[model samples]
Target: MAPVSDYVKIDKNPSLQVTADHRIEVVEAPIEKPGSGKVLVHIKTTGICGSDIHFWKSGNIGELKVLGNCILGHEAAGEVVEVGADVTKLKVGDRVAVEPQLPCGKCFLCMQGDYNLCQDVEFSSVYPYDGTMQRYKVHDERFLHKLPDSMTYAQGALVEPVSVAYHGVERSSVTLGKPAMVAGAGPIGLCTLALAKAMGATPLLITDISAKRLEFAKKFVPEVLTYQIDTTKTNQENAVAIRKIFGDSEYVQPPSVLECTGVESSINTAAYVVRRSGVLTVIGVGRGDINNFPFMHLSLAEIDVKFINRYHDSWPACINLIANKVINVDSLVTHRFPLEDADKAMATSSDPSNGNIKVVIED
Candidate 1:
């Protein structure tokens, strides 16, 4: 064998790792160096997503499981510390929001600008892929969107989820004067509601089972209407209540609905309320097989249902929206924690009883 010096171990950096179910700990990990077309970023803030909680609590999401310890964060913002060769767009000291996705550029989907759907894509915080919850990370330069000087690090981190919402709204085609409904007052739902409002969707409405969350959304966008769902009630009854928010007429159905809850009942209620020939975009990830999806109802109404995996080509618009103050995300961050307190942050976010809308970890 050659000299052992060739295998010298790199120094370690602080990183939060999920070792097993309901466990998270800060551990020292190797500091990865940036390679060609990559840049090393010092992570500043990371937002705890629902998917991250799923991994921390059960070590699995849907059919995917974390076979080993994985760093758990995808929504993040950071400053570039070092840039590798040929990285001309970015330099040291530049602040950016991590896109958290690496797609194979050669794929037909990528060429068609639908890179988020690329089958060979590698997403952060997913099984087997280390995420941005570390002190330092090496990422593709192309995936980092520069944060304007006016945007805060926390707002930069929010760009990821906002991007998801942006894509959903774009797909639903919510435009000026179009009535829109968002099913779920969660982070994604709130983001979708804000985007719909920015797109000039009038008489906007948001729904959730949690009164606290609904209240938060109402305050976040004071103009948008909020409704609390009663699980004990039938879908039709709940749909009627939702319609009543706009007016006392049956023709007040929204032309565009964004389902951000992924719950069976919420989706069915959306189907029940959306206008004929309307579009429904599914932004939340739910069960692999929904037993009663109201397929016949959707087919009969000719309501176009669209599903989004993640988001594609949405970072710039989100950044602009936040930077311009057109979409206010500053109020969406309800809880904040330091990097070392990641576990506590996760716990706070997971508890439905608490009023945590978005819990963020700052480095």
Candidate 2:
């Protein structure tokens, strides 16, 4: 193991901070030391997630507001530069993915294997806890997963979103022959498509308002069908269009519907298109109160509406899926920028017209 001085040049860490809405600045902060059972990581790649864009654009995602000068990032991968006391799992020079959610082990949810629901969990970049946008970040070893030698830093950063996709897919219980529909062409939605295909979901359908995103989805997964939604149409009319695309039959409904857009219209379309007794999983983070939801239809159809928070115990599966080539995430990274241009990166990510899929910030 190397000393902290060898890996860190100075006590201050250069970080990308969201000082206010639509503003990001490079600021210096004191480098946090790794305590016992922790490891200090030199961040290599950080992905600009949709949530990061939400914070950057409005400084809030629904009710969760950024109260002060907050570091803005969570999808991170880096190398362990210094190991804290009693850290045996990882040593210096090991590449790892940072799982930003810290769950309190003593909670009932943690004990029951649903750690993401832990009441005391502290998620990075969410309010009180600072994120991994800085040059150096110290994280508990238990939440960090070691990346394979062949895995790129970008892929490691993707592990977080991949895990999210995996959780949604698992929640929907997508089977080998079951047909699945994903209602967003963003990174997470694309990931959901890949995982659903890997899990044997056939004839996948994906929809989006952006033609660029739909084109990207077509190139990424040529086998799946892509649709460009018309925002001018009503939710029911859009649902009818989707059903028409799948053809008019008694069994036209898909068994699994993954709504990744986080829009009320998309959710309503999902509820309308899903088969009776099928699973409809909401992976996108939308507003706290969703109005005009078709509650009567959902109840009459007995469609299971499941919502996901982050992810729980999905790191290993995501790593293996990427390592084994079950899913290719390398192409998902469309843009890259250094930490110095964090503001530009955020701006690009927030703009849908730029045709950016995944924007990564490299150290």
Candidate 3:
């Protein structure tokens, strides 16, 4: 194996606070050898997710804030560069997708095989942590998923979002012959549509404020209904538009709603349209505490509310689905940039007017 000096480190600049500039700097830090149960990775590709943009712009999200400079790219895939002395699962040059979030193995959630919900976790690209935008990263071997030849670096980078969709699918409980309506046509929402179809959804209808996103999603799932929900219109008028868009399926009653945008009105719409006993999956994070809801109607209608955190123990299944071509993961990536231009990529992802379906940073 080559010496660790052959690789470069992208660490946070301690001096620069929230006023950091656009192009992130790559400095040479100490090349600490993997202690144990760890493997160094040569990053190949990493996707710029929506959360990355939030951190870049506001330098904060909820509790996590950028008090210091941080490397920025998390939904990533790479090849094993070196292994820790005690590591045996992975070897040098093996392609892999990183889970990014390492839960404390001793946590109760980890013991239950639901590490996504573990209270004590070290997630990359968030506050107080460096991300995978660098030339190399030393991560725990347990969090690495070996990539098959059928899966490309970009597709592997998508595993993170796919895992989220997988978790949402599990939460929604939509079986075969059912229609799964995704309320937001962002990357995560479209990923949910892919997973829903893989999970046997007959017709997957998607809605978004932007017609471009809906049009992009239509490339894969033809049965998708892309309707512009006019917020200015009356509730009955908007519902009627959705009704007209998805005309004709007896199962397309808009009951099985997957709300990913976390917009208050979208949430209210989910609360209103879903039938009694139908499931409403909330996957996106709202701005602040939600004080208002159609609670009276929701109570009378008896809607099952579910909020998806990340994903748990679903990497293998998602990888297999991608490798087997069950879903066209490549179609989702509409933009790409080099790691050095991460700021532009992040900004492009932040602006919906750009019509970027998925933005990736290539090595």
Best by lDDT, which number? 2
- Candidates sorted by TM-score, descending order? 2, 1, 3
Candidate 1: 10-residue stretch with minimal lDDT: 1-10
| TM-score, model 3 to reference | 0.90
lDDT of 1 by residue, 164-234 (tens): 89889888858799789999999999999998998999989999999888889988899988889988999
What does candidate 1 score on TM? Answer: 0.94
lDDT, each prediction: 0.87, 0.88, 0.76
Cα-based TM-score, every candidate: 0.94, 0.96, 0.90
Clashes of 3: 0
Task: Please write out the lDDT profile of model 2 over residues 1-363, one tens digit for every residue.
Answer: 435646456456778888655678888867877899998899999999999878877778977788888898999999998888989899888899999988999978899999999888888888778898888888999999999998999999999999999999988858898778999999999999999999988878999998889999999999998778889998888888887777777476687899998988899988988888888999998777899999999999898999998899899989999999999999999999998787788889988888899999999
Which 10-residue window of candidate 3 scores lowest in summed lDDT? 10-19
Tens digit of lDDT per residue, candidate 3, span 98-194?
Answer: 9999898897889988788887888987766667776677789999999998889999999999888888888885778876678888888988888
Query: In terms of TM-score, which candidate is strongest?
Result: 2
